[model samples]
Target chain A: MEKEVILQYLPLYREALLLTLRIGWQGVLLALVFGVACTWIRQLKIPVLKSLVTVYIELFRNTPLLVQLFFLYFALPKAGIRMTPELCGSLGLGLLGGAYMAETFRSGLESIAPIQEESALSLGMTSMQALRYVILPQAATYSISGIVANVIFLLKETSVFSVISLMDLMFTAKDLIGMYAKTLECLTLLVVFYLIMLLPVSVFGSWLERRMRRAEFGA
Target chain B: MKKNQLIAAAAAAVLGISLLSTGTVFADEAFRTLDEIKESGTINIGVFSDKSPFGYVDENGEYQGYDVYLAERLGEDLGVEINYVSTEAASRIEYLQTGKVDIILANFTVTEERAEEVDFALPYMNVALGVVSPDDAVVESLDDIGEDDQVIVISGTTAETYLVKNYPDIKLQKYDAYAEAKTALENGNAAAWANDNTEVIAFAIENEGFTVGIPSLGSADTIAPAVTKGNETLLDWLNEEIVALGEEQFFHADYEATLLDTYGADYEDTLVVEGGAVGTVETEAE
Candidate 1:
């Protein structure tokens, strides 16, 4: 309740807020690249590779992010590979997010009618060309919403990076609580920072969904 | 076509059944506190692998520190092979409770609440809550810290609990392990870091431009070896080991061997607890 207390802890919160944004943005970028690549691989219909992708998705998705993070940050070093906390957190989020996103994208690719691909092929388009011009254009609308959703998810998930000692928002909030012994204020600041990052993404997602609906219904 | 679909469906059903059964079988064989450990002939002792002078791995990738030294002694005393289970400050208790480790000797402070979930032996060492802050903007005392300032503390620590109870006005940032807490302090994410005085002092001495402020706080609590609750046999043996070790001032030797560098000339009397100096004797009846 004291103004002085809040005023004193402002720097910690500021730094934490920045860290959250940095990690969230980096995670989202990494997720997009991996997600797209994994989706492409699944589309290829390779005999054993498809099953391998399935296993990767199932393994990462079914397990808790905290456990995966511990494995990356703590266990891996003992096995002789060392990484900074930021690298560990970003890579972990990317790999996990990529699995979930691949499913979203696979569904998006399936939603496009076979007629589109067939038509592109008749026009002398190669498989990659058909995908790039015909399938992807149609799939983008459906995929956009999923991508936005995943970004938000990645943003929230980045909070767990604090477990490995990244100075992200949650870590800063916790530090603030310890320094001032004010749990409520620190938690409030954290919630507010999260909202600040996520609200725009949610709004953009809604706007994109509406635009896709308008395109579908010829509005 | 219909026959092929049927075959596929049957294969899917079999796979699903096997997956479901696998989970149950694995769960049924989950590690038991005593049986699995004894059969393996190696007792896993979880200790902090980053909190120096307690449990930290050195450059050689070997586990070293005061806790490691004590853990080696405990294994020798128990006549069991020792398998060091490196843990962070936050996961030490979880590691013990989940049977990942047979015992935890991670400079874990004994408290009434934690004692309910995990049994504690007689105190082997004593610890008090403390804080470390950057020397340039040092926190001389608890009152000097501002509300907006974040104090970093490792999660699941007595310092975290103490700050939450007594300094309810200050903001706390908690990391799950010492590695994270130290990084946060280094990155200026927190204005100060709080933990056991021994740890804070060690950190301050090792790193440049950090000083221990509020060097001691709350009540001085004993650090003891902990096992999962209901492991009376293991608990009994640990208490006996602590007493037997105390009789010969083994902890003093431990301090001299492992902690003397960190504490140096001035801190020997203040920081070191000679054996038999703290905690109650474990009687057979209770």
Candidate 2:
């Protein structure tokens, strides 16, 4: 693997990195909103909406993200939806990540003692106020690590968007290999590039986990 | 009543904006004409990014090849900035059909089914199926294909079509991109690789101990620039451009500049179609 080839294509990689982040993060933000909302709905146990949320979680989690992405991109266009590649990618990630995030948040929410909710109610707090103040704060602490892991996975999943022509980092690296036929060099560079992006997130995840642990345990 | 009318007008405006955002769903807006592309000051032309001697990028990261040279010429003649959209053999027609590219110069072979999906300009080059194998185990015919041995092909390519139709029993390893197909061939994962005759020949010449045993497998086909079906204005312009390009023997020049290293002088005249004007040699090269 030549350093020169990687260095020469740095500008191209930078451009692709911007595109990948744009696609991944837009999906990440949407997933965050969807995950939090769905968690609340699932916890509330509304009749029909709860069942619908169950279906979404099961469907997205069970199926491959690539298949979902392909459906959103290629299949929907046939039905006259005609979303652009970026929108399709972001939406796909949002739906897929939302499913996984819902489960993560569910576990965190489940881990909290039920007595906390009862205590808030005893103190004349509304269910909404109790959830927002007492339950949610603890759940956030419980699920911080899982949330970080999900976001990182979501970022990596955006690489598959290139199959639908979204031009993420993997797509650019594949194109470079196709152009130069330097498979090893370009792919090695891609590995390094992804590590560069994910390392900080992992480090911060551990730091946040430690801080959250200390806060919760009073240590 | 006035307040009601204002509310109705606001609703109508919202609906109109929503329609405008997803308006391309309508079939009419699925394709753009020459006028529209010219108005935009850029023409998105699909060309190969990895296939050497046709359309490939150089060490400088700039797109170059025989097809790239032609597309550049077309862009110059039309006075539009050519935004080169890299494409593969399987995706060329879809690229045009979906309006991702206004034109495709990606070593696209003129085929009846493809012609139904996209309009082809006059031929600029020629192609046929060719198979390359290791020198020790050269495959001269389909009969030479072993029961378990696989022939590697890039999906969506004519060579894949030819092989599947003629020799259904042969195990086939398919890849979508040239890099993967070539890598599969190099890895000895497959007995041989079959592709465009020009590509096979070039590959054999470039790589030692590889030979184009079946140099010509399918009927001769012409390579042409293609636009979306019914894109007559652009098609006519491209046809004219090809004719104009031929006046200077431009394809021969393209061959010398881009293809000479791989194909040499002997294959130049046979491979170059020269804008449908010169009909000298049949595409079957020995």
Candidate 3:
């Protein structure tokens, strides 16, 4: 590849990297919020809502994320719901991540002893207050490892956004290969880019898992 | 306990019915192409943003090329602001079918298989398939390629399909877009790259030490603007515009101005389409 072409590609790669990070972080935030809400709804033991949550989780979890993204980006607009590619990607990732996160939080909530909620309630605390002060604090500690892992999954999932022309890192890499005709160099750069973004998340997840394990054994 | 189970079954049945009803409602709302363009005021014209001399970005970071020039004219004709929607060779049809773009001006070659899904306007340009290889390589014909030799082609292109069907023995590496396929060729991932003669010639001219070995493989196929099927009003207007432009040889001027650099002094008559006129001379006489 010519030095000039490489130079030209750098900006596109940078933009794509930023897009991936943006999608990943946004999906993580949405997952956290929605996951917590879904977990709490399940905790309420409302039979109808519980079943609905189950269906939602099963549907998204079982299907491939690419199909979900295509549905959001291509199908939704046909129904008069127009969204930009970035929004479609993030929303799709968020919804899919939310389903997985709900299951993660559910497991965390289940691990917490029912006696803790009972004790808080006996002390004249309302259900919401007990959830806020007593239940969530413990659940967050248990779910932190799962959330970190989910973030890694979300980072990889952002690649799918390129199909709708979101200009994420994979898209940029593909573009570079096309424009410069430097297949190996462009692909190597993309692999390095993904590793740089994701390695830290993987390490963090491992560390958090260890800490959680230590906490459990200590108790 | 029995009552609770009965209530749960009723709830599940209700949920199933509601979901089915919502699905039907969505199905009933047919997507209209004209309505979408009018609503947005931005007519999405799918053009290849990477194919040089046809559709590519200039140094000024503007989308300026032959295809872009035509797309702008179409936008003006429609009285809607143009939004250049970049597409790869493979997904251009998907973009049109899914209503992501109103029309595809990408270097789209007309074929019978493609015509079933989308309607093609009169031929704006004529193109033939070609192959490019490194100058050091001795690839005279498709037969010269070894059984192990990998040929690079842009995914979802007629070249890719033709090679696979005609020469199944030759290995092929398909990329999603033109840029990737070219890169694959440059990096020695493939022995040669097959695409339209116009694109291959442009590549050979711009990049040193490359030559188009097979300049014209198939019969001349016309490249044209395409839209989703059943849009009679839009289709009729486009057909009229093509025939009108053909009378003055406007598209030839377009080729001379934008493409003559890549093609040079030779092959102009054989390679370039002079006018936008449609209909065989025999048919016209009848």
Best by DockQ: 1
TM-score of every prediction relative to native: 0.62, 0.56, 0.55
**How far in Å is the alpha carbon of A153 misplaced in model 1?**
6.2
For the second chain, the TM-scores of the candidates in order are: 0.83, 0.88, 0.84
Task: Report how large a share of the reference interface contacts model 1 reproduces.
Answer: 0.13
lDDT of 3 at B223: 81
**Native-to-model Cα distance after best TM-score fit, residue B19 in candidate 1, in Å:** 15
Cα lDDT, model 2, residue B10: 55
lDDT, candidates in the order shown: 0.75, 0.79, 0.74
* Local accuracy of candidate 1 as per-residue lDDT tens digits, B1-286: 3355446545755565465446434533333445556667889888877878778899999999888888999877767799888876556555655567888888877777676556777776777888899999999788988867878877667787788888888877767777767866876667899889988988899999999877988887777888876777777677777878877878878888898888886766565555535634231212
Instruction: Name the lDDT value of residue A41 in candidate 3.
Output: 87
- Assess the local accuracy of residue B53 in candidate 2 as a C-alpha lDDT between 0 and 100: 71
lDDT tens readout by residue for model 3, A1-219: 255656766776777788799888888888778787888788788999999988988988998888887677556655667675568788888889999999888888877899989999999999999988887777767888788878888889888765554667886666444333354456556765776688667666766766665445135
Question: Interface RMSD computed for candidate 1 is what?
Answer: 13.5
Tens digits of per-residue lDDT for model 2 on B1-286? Answer: 3355446545755565455435434422466788998899999999888899789988998999999999888888878999999997666765675688999989987776566556788888878889999998999997889998888877677777777678889876656678656755765657899999999998898888899999987888888888887788888888888888788989999999999988889998789877566475432221
Best by TM-score: 1
